[model samples]
Target: MDLKDEFYSAVDAVHNNISFEATTANEISTFETSIRFLGGLLSAHDLSGDARLLAKARDVGDMLYKAFDTPERMPIPKWDFHAALDEGSVQGSPGQLLLAEMGSYSLDFTRLSLLTRDPKYHELAARITDLLYETQMTTKVPGLWPSHVGLTADSLDRGSDYTFGAEADSAYEYTAKMVALLGGQVGQYEEMYARSVDAAAKYLFYRPLNPGDEDILVSGTARSHAGSGAPWTETSAQHLSCFAGGMLALGGRLTGNKSHVDMGGKLARGCVWLYKGGPRGLLPEATMLVACPDAGDCAWERDIGVWHDALRRKYGTSKPVEDVIADNRLPQGWVNIYGGCYILRPEAIESVFVLYRVTGDRKLMDEAWEMWAAIDKATRTAMANSAVEDVNPPGGKRLRMSDSMESFWLSETLKYFYLLYSEPELMSLDEWVFNTEAHPLRRMLS
Candidate 1:
């Protein structure tokens, strides 16, 4: 059958047979359900103007809303949907919750409210954002909340580790995007985003000690050090953290901050640099880099011996520096490959797509094309694309493939690649705001 026939058939199958209750898993992820399924249905409705999709989306929304029925009305990271529905039993929120899990529901929930004209959905989601804003400044680091936090009002400052990665990445991301999605009516999101970005620039972003001394920044973790009396930066980078580039660019344009847009460009280029310098022109899941003393004014280390010495010290290796260097065969600026696998992640391309839309720079498009080519070459299999077992393979040999494929390969990664080259006016940035999963929700603003 043709593509349009296949699309209609798939939608009909979902509308006729899909049921949230059919799953046998005891628990469900609030974040995953919201983005992958609810957001998908809503965006599909937005695109196809299908009332059936909206009905399906509303059913999922109602089921997910039960997750926020805790004592403090904070969402449980892992929700027991069966208990909530079958036994009328709901558990209290956990002592510590991931910021992303609690904070990432705004876009989907808010859009659900607007579409269904049900304020309850939006109200439940707004309460979470309200608590986040109230606690944003009072955290261990002012203006940015920690990766983990307590749900109760009394225990808001329960965790200290902070980063724009993993558990905390999308919280900051949603803040900026929410501003656009809500048409800037909510000033709190804009303020929260600006403060968090400012703090991140000062503490969480660092320049890598590369040969070119390129003016690019990568997001990293920070912790309060007792001896230094300040937060110390960890120069480890994650592919997941690459979304910060797009988040920064979108926020800058919405808030009219030129510097943020410029910084976004540099950060996007930094991810491209990682892809180009890797063993097979693909970024690993995680890597460590030698950090420059200053992010704004960085100079490359002149002594190659010093670079090797630093790596040895960082890894606490007893072997000779030369031997240490020979074992890893790391690229310049990279000290260690904490996670060498490539799991078909989409964050780098997500940033590239956003920056191209924001800047209209054709160079970003070229960079994106190179990234697509590398990924297609390295991951393609007979059945489908697989994850790379090692992005930094030894001996410059062929990359080893793992027999795994994540849903994001189709949901977010391929979507970004397609949108990168598609006409800009199709799902235009001004018209739609994407959730953390890259599902495009129609913007309410004119």
Candidate 2:
């Protein structure tokens, strides 16, 4: 529509309100702030050649510089905006750092630097990627990094749970995308991505006993320690994990690696398989992967729905339990499955857009349509769209509707749906690669 002036004025107000030079009372964040605000400003400039947008992007980039003021060169996941006056809780070693926040810093910064002719922005961007490289190198898993890291805590060498979902998902995505954005000029990203693909294949990927009626393989988390390996757990892959397929496919297409593309296709189809298994045909926050293995022969022979207390006392969640039973839970093998309501996550359909774009697979397009219809049937409400509390109800029958809508629902999921079904040339993948948040960043070679 003819809303360019309104959009420009609105963005101008935001630009004036925010003091990107130094922190005031606002807190700074990466995944939320950078991916949306910064991504928005930079994207606007690129799309419309608006100098005002570029200026705002530069200011935001400068304001974000304080976030990187860490000893280890790792950007603090969150920054205190008032650190300019040295107020409460400044940026430094984070108590807990999310991988997505730490890892997904580059595209916006890189764009800012290229446009502004500033080297500092590039330096800041490089440090985050550099830290990601070193952190993955030290991790117990060959390619995968832990989901959460302390200012200095280790889960594998110590005990923190790891999963390639939610906060950790975007980090891996940025790696492949940075490679595409910079055009293979950077070898480190491609190298790290390759290692991750291989490691995921060997460790995280599994053939699970699922409702699909066929032996279907899906990727989950790897729970092995140094000098010890364990069988993959039955953690139902979250819809967040669905992005792996697109990320994989992007990596493969950029590098001419068929195996990566093939693996990505499987993961993408596996996500569709998840939708197929749901009661209402809408994807849940999570889907059942492998059925949880029995705790033990006694654990199984005793009861079907009850867990064996003695088995828990015996296993104690160590490497020894791998051979006994992975994801040993109360019973029924649902211990790994978080039967949460369908929360309209974007990862599944997001991947469909990518796979369809790359392979031109019309089947993926059809799946996207099916998913859209299911979402419409399940989520439409009297006031506005709402997420279902459960998908088990027929036609979303008696489903409690959430009043709130996630930003990604508009920015990403539905956007992907439109693009997936739109002309392939509208936003051609050859000219652009989206940020983890689905903001289109033009692929420019320097």
Candidate 3:
């Protein structure tokens, strides 16, 4: 328990840095706060049987719950906990969900319900997902979901683009884990996970391999929007989307599905490829046009009508998608179009840890070891670890530093590394499902 004690002590000290008596409402960032703070405290309580952790989780969870107020379909943003004042956007179209905010609350909230024996927290988290299901009842994409949505907007069509990054990353994660955490008590999550994955396999799962080689299914966005005559587009995968592989692998390994296991292995390999092939062995935020080489390419006055015209006007190109991809390949001074910084993100190696636990391959461990060395070398600073602003420095040149170190550095990154590097019997994948924030919830799989 030495590591656990150290972890608890370090995190406990963080509370002293905040002011409970501050006059202003602390900015409530649901996406970050829920995963790092609420998820951390709750998971610690689960793992250590610590009541203090539960109390902190309750306080923070209730404080952040203030954002859920509003007539809008999604939670409002940025509430002052003490003042009861909200400063979330006034321009939101009703019902449009921020995929990250809307989709990623189940772990902490469900755990809160388990601890408190109150269903309100579970219902609170479950309701947003119910809304997502309702939206799918009228979806534009057949099997895939838009990364963002407005509750009552014009029905989404097959041709619109979607993402698995920043504005939307963790929704898909919450789905599978929620059902697992609740032991199928909340069946909607199960339905949504199955439906989404089925749709994705048909539309977004790109198996870039020969007939019989080990499967390397790259999971990305699926957009079938074409002029009346053009082809559907498979979008590029992001570093963030790396989480999909682990989810699939864990789901497959837990359920005994060889296909999902194969795809999960492949997807994990694909994300690692981004880091290995990147300039400094640090994954870029986006991998541009990798999955969509000729997306929207059509001839005979391809019906891409208005959106195509708008694309041309914005970027001054006949093939906007291709142009955008090309631009992403360029490197600016402090930033790269494909997102140059290594912002202490943990999704790739997190998947690597999952893949290793699922498959027991030593190669993944060696790769992860090297990757960790590169990151530690690049990100170390005197005061605290900083994000690398531009990792693509000249040979033997050091990376530029950014001013921030995100909380995931502790909650997910360090946690995964510790677990991954530990003995296999500890927190084994067969026994637990971790939420997007890397909080392990212990449960016996069906």
Candidate 4:
């Protein structure tokens, strides 16, 4: 496995051929480019101490720097690289700006600044974080920003829907990670993370009414009420939100909050339960669950009449409650499968790896092994593993295969799986902190 020749050959190819000067795509995602390419190159250079990798990373970093040329200096989520190069200026979009896209750039740019001994990169990234922190309390829901905001007119309070899901997940994640990456010297990162996570736990975290009455928590969405009432919680869960467990656990360890660590374990276990609950032993991309009134104290509703009544309230007389139940054919607590496909996402395992590191829990590793076995058996293809169309198919039928494999399948999913079994000393959390894409950037202080 120590194929040095192959590694150098691949590096040489990238160094020689890869260029951001002429991208074929009309537009590129700043978040995706920063995390996948810039973060990857920086981590690779840190591991190999190779000048070429740093050079290539610098090239990518320069291209990404063009994204912050807006009038307000806030980065445009999507950058037209060629157009910007030609015009020597960039314009911010008038549409809604995603929270994750705008907020997830601090780590990569700050790392680049440290390595290159340039303050400009860190300064540019810090401006965005400053804006986010300033606007955090002004949103409809204090301490939590919506999924999107208006950046062109400098309005950060544009959207109302809130969730720690796809569009908004990594914003909170970076807040905690930035605390580690900068050696917690900033203080504001920790404050921002603490406030946001506290709000999330109060409004978004809930216990599912599973038949086993498992003591675990799942993050859900919340809608701010029109008046001064509490935000209404939605019981739907997303596979992407699985990262909250690791985020919370890491933040707790960094900030000396034992409660966050305990809650994190509960959240991590919920995903493990979902993996084991599915027919394929893999979690669906998204699912709806019946929530207990109090997440802190929950007991399973044993009466089938309650489930029937809940289904009736959800579906009405449009369809028989029995048919609705049979159509989903899910476990007792799961009301329906919003997204049935398993697209080889890494969020669940990412949390498992992190929790194991934070708690030294061997049981988490065993659970991870079971998940890997199930996923391999169901998704293995001749060339490589493919995604399955249905993770909870009825009647034990075969899972339909899809010809899609995302980059994170390797960068994050398998990396976390491998690290779970590796020695604890290898990439220990004390010495390294992972970005959203699971790239392990070396911590400045251990």
Q: How far is candidate 3 from the true structure (C-alpha RMSD, Å)?
A: 7.0
Query: Candidate 2 on 5-53: residue-level lDDT in tens?
Result: 9988887887678666554447666457788878888887877787888
After superposing candidate 2 on the true structure, give the runs of residues whose Cα lies further than 4 Å from its correct spot.
1-6, 12-26, 87-91, 150-159, 210-216, 225-231, 291-339, 393-397
> What's the distance in Å from true for residue 322, model 4?
4.1
What is candidate 3's local distance difference test score? 0.65
State candidate 4's TM-score: 0.95
Q: Over all chains combined, what TM-score does candidate 3 have?
A: 0.78
Per-model TM-score, in order, reads 0.95, 0.83, 0.78, 0.95
Backbone N/Cα/C clashes per model: 0, 2, 9, 0
Deviation of model 2 at 401, angstroms: 1.3
RMSD of 1: 2.1
- Candidate 4 on 1-446: residue-level lDDT in tens? 36789988989999898987778998898889999999999998877888999999898889888787777777777777777876545475535578888888899899999899988888988888888888887777888988887663357777777888979998899999998988899998999999898888877888887778789999998887446577778888899999999998999999999899998999999889888887678888898877875555666654455556778887786888778877767666777788999999999999999999999999998999999999899889999999988887777687889988999999999999999999999999888999888888888886
Q: How many Å off is the CA of 100 in candidate 2? A: 1.4
Tell me the TM-score of model 1: 0.95
lDDT, candidate 1, at 225: 32
